[model samples]
Target: MNHESQKTTIANTVQLGSDLSVNRLGYGAMRLTGQPGNFGRYADWTAGKQLLRRAIELGINFIDTAESYGPGYNEELIASALYPYPDDLVIATKGGVLKTAPDNIRTDGSPNSLRRSCEASLKRLKVDRIGLYQLHRPDPNVPFVESIGMLAELQREGKIRHIGLSNVTIAQIEAARQIVDISSVQNRLNLAERNGEDILDYCTQHNIAFIPYSPLGAHPLKRGAPLANAEGILTEIAARQDVKPSQIALSWMLHRAPNIILIPGTTTISHLEENIAAASITLTADDIKLLNEAQVF
Candidate 1:
């Protein structure tokens, strides 16, 4: 289908790599698992399962998860929701971070450990080949090249269709680019976090899909309160555009770069719909400048 035609298709997918194509709007399954390690704390498993189903129903073909989340709970939930999976859906999962405890997340880039994690992720995801497998973090203990080389090996073996990196530096991204084709880069970025700007710009220049995790801050936004202090720019511009502050925040990211993709996760269906709808709002150049100059982060 043509690009414009595909845009209207919720199941419409876009190719980010030689073998990876997923819907523009996607879901993140981290919240499906319970706090600490169980599945009982957040919401009903049946309800969580329905959330996944609803996301697909809304045309979110890109679903992101990590092995470190619930250490394994998110992947299993994804399998339950998507097994006998849709042909157009893309399942992206991360490795490299090991959860010592629910609150204590550590990065381990040992080649052997990465292989083992990929094997396990494959089993839990119920797919012979992952659509996009990412290295969750760069391991200080292992040479970066060695870690990326292993992912390249997996791609060649048909175990992973594409490779991506998360929480990496520009130098690290450049280094990985040399070892293998990097299709996507996941990083923590929000209206409150601009530390990843350089990498985000680099990805734009290189034609890589930049996926922003936590595009909305983890903090609770007060009801009817502005995103910034009174008279702050976020509120002013959002008011001018007739959009919510969160929508403005997301629209700023999309305005920053066209290659950017957002996977804002929430257990609440209303919030999920709001996040997806942000893509429809357009930010003018002036709107982007105000957001960039706000200096909140």
Candidate 2:
């Protein structure tokens, strides 16, 4: 009922690269694989598949996933859920990292590794070319330019449609542009974490999509004392809105930037619906000012 009535859910969309266009509020497939560390097989694979299918039925066309998620299973799960592929669906995926543990994330940005990952992802996703392929992380062991070169090569070969970068800096993005046309950038952004502000600003100015993962942000926020003070301010606002604190938290991101494409992941259906509905909640100017002040970091 809410899905049908939430008329303002991401009413606008931003273009990505040459062809792909997606609703601003998209779904992240990371949580479908399992818990946060997300290093293993999904406990309930069927439910995961169903959730992906359901998301599409709800009008979410852009689904963000990564090869590291399930390291492979997540992509396969997607193929199973929506294999023939809808014409408008943009299934974006990332590579260049392997999840060994919940806390451990390793990168292999070698040309060979990058190529192999892209090929593997293409097969599992059941697509000749990925709509959006992003470099997951910059490997300190490998030259960043070389990694971007590999993506450029993939683009020329027609394996990747649009190129994106994740967990990158402004200099890195500028460096990547020399090698390929960067369409989007995925970074950790949310109401609680404001460190990616500069990168986001650059993306917006360039007309590139800023796909923000962890849009609700992490728990036990690192900003100890300052965050504690801000929560009181945030809670007060939420009480006035008659919505959950988390909803107000996500709504802030939706209103924060037009270029920000949110991918807040969750396996629960209720949470999925809640996230989709965030684009419908319009935060007033005063509300935006309040949330901005709450981000003490």
Candidate 3:
């Protein structure tokens, strides 16, 4: 795997389900909310709106959000910023999670809860039909089929265009498929986390979109923070490419698999631009090999 001459370029766009097509590099809106626990409305609402508009101007058509983010403010913020969305823009949101406080979050996958969540999201998003609605997480108390079946019912009723799952396993995905057609799977994946590799492979084989949240890792790494082997490899590659270490980390994922769709979130304009620019990076086989062998945190 040392092809220095041959370079692999990531595709610009990927198809979601059958009809919807989104950019391989998408924007995640979780960071736009209040800090500490993402518990309340964004302190700088105006700035947040501007950042979102800039995202679309930068060719990011896929925006990922969840009802749990701000509990309901995130969806409203999106609608406020880009309600009359572009024809090609795709908004994917999640349900089944309830958050009253930052420290207190729980999952409820029952049909009644899902139905209410879907309807509320429809209202907040100001859309007749949601582009994509995902189960935020599976509840231990509720049967998995019942939760997926509820989404299926909503799909049939024209409330949700496509169904997806988040924080799920391969067994859960296979189970959900029996109840409805799963269009995507959202999981945590980065250079430091490879636990979701098998699930990513499964989605790739099935031609299902695999959305990787936390593409920069779940725990934020501050400037000059120590990250052991993963950071060393990323820094070395970044130095060689004359790019940011974060960009190198993201580019590695784009080269890892074809089906992977990234939703890296940032609050600043510069970071947003850097993230979108990562899609243009073409990694060599050697670069990929080194990144693949890097230790996971």
Candidate 4:
């Protein structure tokens, strides 16, 4: 695996909306918060801050977070760690979701709810205008257009630079577009989850960024779990490439589309470096074919 040669085949930067050009391999800050449900502040605040600094040092300018991540704490943590941010850093955070407790979470896309959420996020992030503000999820009780309309209104007021949607379908994306310019669509997608392929294709055709939240599998495999299926193929390719299986998975997605922007999150510095290193991996054609065909567990 000659990284120098493979580097030419992959595009490192992706446009977030029209103005912000960020690295395709970004960092997700969800894990920086407390665990069990990511409810409170991270137990190890010092270590979490160090990890975030390391991400930026590794050239990750695009950082993904949400007002709901700590219900307010995550954004505050970011400000505390890197308040006097670099000029090029683009901090993308989501609203429209509320977390009362780790287990008790709900969506509130109402105009009033969205306004409050956006304002609170601004205060927490210590930014006058958010670089990219996303609707975390569409509320079933509220009209989707109305929810999106509020974001459009905020954008017009210069509160939000760009508007994005999460957990949406093609129909939803089109509907949101009717209200305002949709900058990006984030969804759960990875080797184990391929349900968002159609959404990925739609975003690709329209030139909108497609941010995959879980570039790795969602659920953790138990210790010594059997690798009889796609996991085996992933492991085999990783061995051949002299990389970890997770790296192979992320590289496949980067190879899968030019518009993909990955936000694979981690708390440890080692895993953070590993995720960034995944960008340098370029999978072989045969490896891509087998992994594409095999069903991941």
What is the C-alpha local distance difference test score of each model? 0.79, 0.82, 0.88, 0.86
Backbone clashes in model 1, listed as residue pairs: 10-59
Give the distance in Å from residue 6's predicted Cα in candidate 1 to where it truly belongs. 25
Residue 246 of model 2, lDDT score: 70
Which TM-score value belongs to model 2?
Answer: 0.90
Q: Write the per-residue lDDT of candidate 1 for residues 1-297, one digit (tens) a residue.
A: 443332221223445886566656677777777753422234477888889998988888899998887778789888887789989888899999898665566789988889999999999998899989999999999999999999999899899988999989999999999889999999888777888888989988998888988777654221221232334788788787686777778667766676777787778888778778877876665666667789654
- Local error of candidate 4 at residue 271 (angstroms): 0.1
Q: Write the per-residue lDDT of candidate 3 for residues 114-207, one digit (tens) a residue.
A: 9999999999999999999999999999999999999999999999999999999999999999878899999988777888999999999998
Q: What's the residue-level lDDT of 57 in candidate 4?
A: 95
Q: How are the candidates ranked when ordered by lDDT, highest leading? A: 3, 4, 2, 1
Q: Estimate each model's TM-score.
A: 0.87, 0.90, 0.95, 0.94
> What stretches of model 1 exceed 4 Å from their correct place?
1-14, 36-43, 219-231
**Candidate 2 at residue 208, lDDT?**
92
Q: Write the per-residue lDDT of candidate 2 for residues 60-109, one digit (tens) a residue.
A: 99999999987687888889889899899999999999877766778999
What lDDT does model 3 reach? 0.88
User: Which of the two candidates, 2 or 4, achieves a greater TM-score against the reference?
Assistant: 4
Model 4 — TM-score against the truth? 0.94
Q: What is candidate 1's CA lDDT for residue 5?
A: 39
